[model samples]
Target chain A: MKLRDFVLRRIILAIPVIFGVLTITWFLSYVVGDPLAMYVTERTPDAAIPGIIRARGLDAPLVVQYFLYLTALFQGDWGVSTTTGADQPVLTVLARLFPATIELSIVAMSIAIVLGIPLGIISATRKDKAADHVTRVFALIGVSMPIFWFGLMLKYVLFYQLSVWDLPHLPGGDRYNFRAFGSWQPTTGFLLIDSLLFEHNPALFLDAVVHLIMPAFCLGYITLAIITRMMRSSMLEVIKEDYITLAKSKGLSERVVIYKHALRNALIPTVTVIGLAFGGLITGAVLTETIFNWPGLGRWATNSILNSDIAAINGFTLLVAFIFVIANFIVDMIYGVLDPRIRFG
Target chain B: MSDELVLHVKDLYVNFYTYEGIVKALDGVEMFLRRGDTMGVVGETGCGKSVTAKSILRLIEAPGRLDDGQILFFDQDFETKETIELDLAKLELEEMLEIRGNRISIVFQDPATYPNPVFRIGDQIAEVIELHQNLAMDVLYMKIAKLELTLSEATSDENRAEIEGKISYYRQQLDDPPEPDKKSMREAAKLKAIEMLRLVRMPAPEQVVNQYPHELSGGMRQRALIAMSLACNPSILICDEATTALDVTVQAQVLLLLNQLKAEIGTSIIVITHDMGVVAETCNWVNVMYAGTTVESCATEEIFAKPLHPYTAGLLIAVPKLHEVKDRLPQIRGTVPNLITPPTGCRFHPRCDYATSVCKEKKPLLEELEPGHWVACHHPLRS
Candidate 1:
């Protein structure tokens, strides 16, 4: 099959997957609680309650409501959030928050790949040695440690305790300080890039990076742990393949045999884990965002749920599902590239 | 160089430490190879034929240790007129790099899995050629510089004559026609790899060189592997069941290729396999192994004509004759003994029809029953 057909087929297949996610989320969001309860108060007039229900389309039948929701969704109408009381569109809210989450995820994933893969390679090649044991233990601790606690502990050490040493206090719980940075004019919505591009200040970029460091680390800890452990086991498995022995028998150095011959084949499965982990990272950011006060989508989604802002919750679910499906599609393309057998098939 | 012993493996002992027990993979295995000879080490599965071949280059990994062995490699170059004896086991990995593939190379079984899938054919073949050939030239260059230094200081005619002779010898080692430029060495190696591919009978050598291993057919891949092995003109070529994975026609083609190489390249060959037919077709001398030990060793024709060991007799009988009519072809009874806890005395006794009390009690050493034939059995067959 041609590469063009393969890509096209994958994209067409994603439509149903996205539709299924939206249907499930729509049902679950309504089942949790009635969205009308937020607007209804003890002193409210009984006549005003029906008017609010009709205005929000809450009085419509379940099927009618779902179709209305789908129609509005296709027109890019994410509906309004009742949590802030100002009634802001969920799309506008996402625009304000997603950049922060994206920025955090990028930092975290970069750290995961840069540190995790080589460390994993080292662990596998060293096998049962002290280096392997040390990496395994570190990954174990990283996995078991709760993100909230890890985030708070980092805040305590890097943000609070270092004040006495005259080190620049690390920022946590927010994207950037509005007072010091002068209200960040939206450019890319990514603060670090925007601070330099629109604000045109090097010091602001540095401040943005420092503010990002703690939350990104806490957010990325689990992903790093998972990738490291996955890569080590994968590398160990590929190293035992007959091709590796063949490489060594050819009198190639141990370096070439391990990295070139073993690592490339091993990376096929590792890439899948990485793609899934990226999708998970976007959703898993809730606790880290809460602790660090990072104004990201997770924090907004949590606020939406507490206020019974059904439309905002539904919209968030659709976005998350779309991200995951797209990530997986990209992973499949990479798999074909990595293994020729898959490419031809 | 043609008449000299190129490889001599003496009293080689390899043990694999497993949870069950110490698996005696190779028990005092001994074999020697003269230059230009094609020797076959034939055995049934699990009999340590492949292990012996790997032991020569110290390619055996952990869990398996070379407990006691001396792989004496006699390194002699006719062009350079240099001679050295290297006990391979005693050499460090760095030192072994100099000899591995450069002086001794291997072609493994299952060529499908042997060449790295990610690498281009040319790059893989060129790698060995560059490492061995480039390093050889570097060493030669160093020697030439030292010879020039010695010649400058020498006042006596005797000393000058000696220095000049040594200088010319080292210079000749670089190139036959004295293309002494070091820069062209890498290009020379690449050209040599292309030539080697053509020699292996690979069609469209230029196209195949750029293609990945996965693009090639099984026989073509095996032929490419053969080309890589012969790249450095290794004096000792170990083919560890090289033709086992090939089809019958490809097997014939490969075996024929090896025979042609033996006459053309003049490299001593160690062909390890379980196939009796391969031994009959390609080998001048044969070593029949039974459970980590050399049970019988003789000239290939003699072993077939008048088999001495009962085990050898059984193996010969197991091979079906083309014209012979029978309900069932003869088979050697009993399975291969578990190496973790092998049968104590004369491992073949359990299956041997001629087993005696003495055969069950004593383990026999290889005895030279005839002038050139050796057998490790208590009760020998009469010619």
Candidate 2:
């Protein structure tokens, strides 16, 4: 086949992948929660219910509603979050929360990458040795423990038990930092950003960093363990390949062969795992944000669910879908960047 | 110079530590490759030919370990040393990289499986360049462009240049490289890559270089890989049953290409194949392996004419040659022995027609019966 034609085919294939995400988001809003049930409960006046239903556009056909939602998505209108009285647009909510979530997620991913890949490589290379066994044990514990427990444990140890971190007070149920955040503004709506942009004092930056550390670490710790194990297994498999053997035959250093040849190939599968996890991270840290009172989407969604706020629920649901789709998309793009064999599809 | 062996695999032993027990993959096999010799090691699926090739640079992973062996490489051409006996058991991670792909490259049997599905063909090739070469930036770029241009028509020199330059720029931003050079080593590497691809007789060498493994046909990808292996001009080339996955016609084509490359470039080759036809067609030396051991070793014509080992003779008889097709083709009884606990005596004793009491009690030594021929058996079946 012609080379250009093959690439063109891949691009065409990606269109469906994007559309698939959109469809999944729309379908999830309907089945995931009873929007109708919540819609009526708020204003159950028999006469007002229909008007509310009609006004909310819930009365429209599924396909039409979906089309409208998709059209609005393109127009950058993610609809309104009815519950927060934040009444902010869906995309706006994402914009406000995305930076924070992304910052948290990126920090988490960075932690995972920096620590995980090396640990995995080391563990794999060492094999049955004590060091390998230790790493394996750590990875096993990391995997078996749930992220929610880790968040609570960290909060207890750092904030209560150790008294290492003295938060003057928790933010109560939402994510606004009412504490004396010294001269910080919402430049990026991210603590690191606001701290960097607005605060002149080094202490504020340090505080913001300190605040970020616990939640990010809690969120990313499991991912790091997962990545390390995945990377190790992948690396182990690739290192045994004849090509790697050929690399060694060339008299190249073991470090060069594994890093340059084996690790690079191993990353192909690892990218898939990392991408899915990144999507999960982007959807907002549910447990970690709740434990830290970080006010990200996870905490917001949970509160909205409890309040039975349909708008917030739908908006957050669609937003989570958006983040997931975008995450996969970005991962797809990165696969090509990292390995080169992956096309857009 | 004729006796200047480029690589010597001495008494190689490889074992995989599975949950069951130690899987003796490769056991007590020895061979060598001269500067320009293309040697073939042939055996059945579980016979340890591929493991032997991988043992050269200690590419085995856990729970596989190189139990015993030495890999000797004469890297004098690059001003390293004349004779370096590489211990297969231990090596620092960093030092092993130089030996892999940089000095001794390999091409696998499955061409489709060769590429990482996540990366582009150009990037994968460029990575090898990044590791091995110190070429100018412009040249490195030109080389990639030229390689891409050969594989895909749309991947123009401009686009290749742009992409490669972007990669270099990104690397520079990370402070990974020293200062930028006037003529990019990137372009030179690209040109060198193009020249190598063209030499492999790939049509549209410019287009094929840019095309991904999936984009090209099976034959083309194999050719591209062959071109990639030739990129650094390594002293030893290992083709691990490289043509086993291709059709007979494509296999012949690739084999012919390997022979041609061997003649033109003087790259010593270790062709790990199970196909006897391939050994006869491509290799100067043939090493017949059975149960991880070199049961018989001889020159191409000599071994075929006067196969001394009963196993080698059995193999020749089992195969239906072009000259005659028997109604009941001769078949060897008994399957490959379990490697977990390999047979105590001669591994092939149970399957051998000439097996005796001594064959079951004592293992035979690999002795040089003639000047160049080596046989390992209690009683050889030579006329």
For each candidate, report what fraction of the true interface contacts it reproduces: 0.45, 0.49
TM-score of chain A of 1: 0.95
Query: Please, what are the lDDT tens digits per residue for candidate 2 over residues B1-383?
Result: 28777777778888899999999887788776777788889888889987777677566667788888776676655575556655434666666666677778888788776655444455456557656876544453454556455445545678667666655554454433444463465545555666777888888877766666678888887887787787788878899988999998999999999988887877889999877888888888888999998898888998888999998888888878888857888878898899999887899999988999999899898889878889999999863
Q: Ten-residue segment with the worst summed lDDT in candidate 1 chain A?
A: A336-345
Residue A56 of model 2 has an lDDT of: 75
Q: Which candidate's DockQ is highest?
A: 1
| Candidate 2 CAPRI classification by DockQ | acceptable
Q: Per-residue lDDT of A167-286 in model 2, one digit per residue for the tens?
A: 453222223344664234577677666666665556666665667777887788888888989988998888767556544544556686678778878887787888788877765488
- Each candidate's number of clashing pairs is 2, 79
Q: Which numbered prediction scores highest in lDDT against the true structure?
A: 1
Error of 1 at B252 (Å): 1.9
RMSD of each: 8.4, 8.0
**Chain A TM-score vs. truth, each candidate:** 0.95, 0.82
Instruction: Indicate the residue-level lDDT of A59 in model 2.
Output: 86
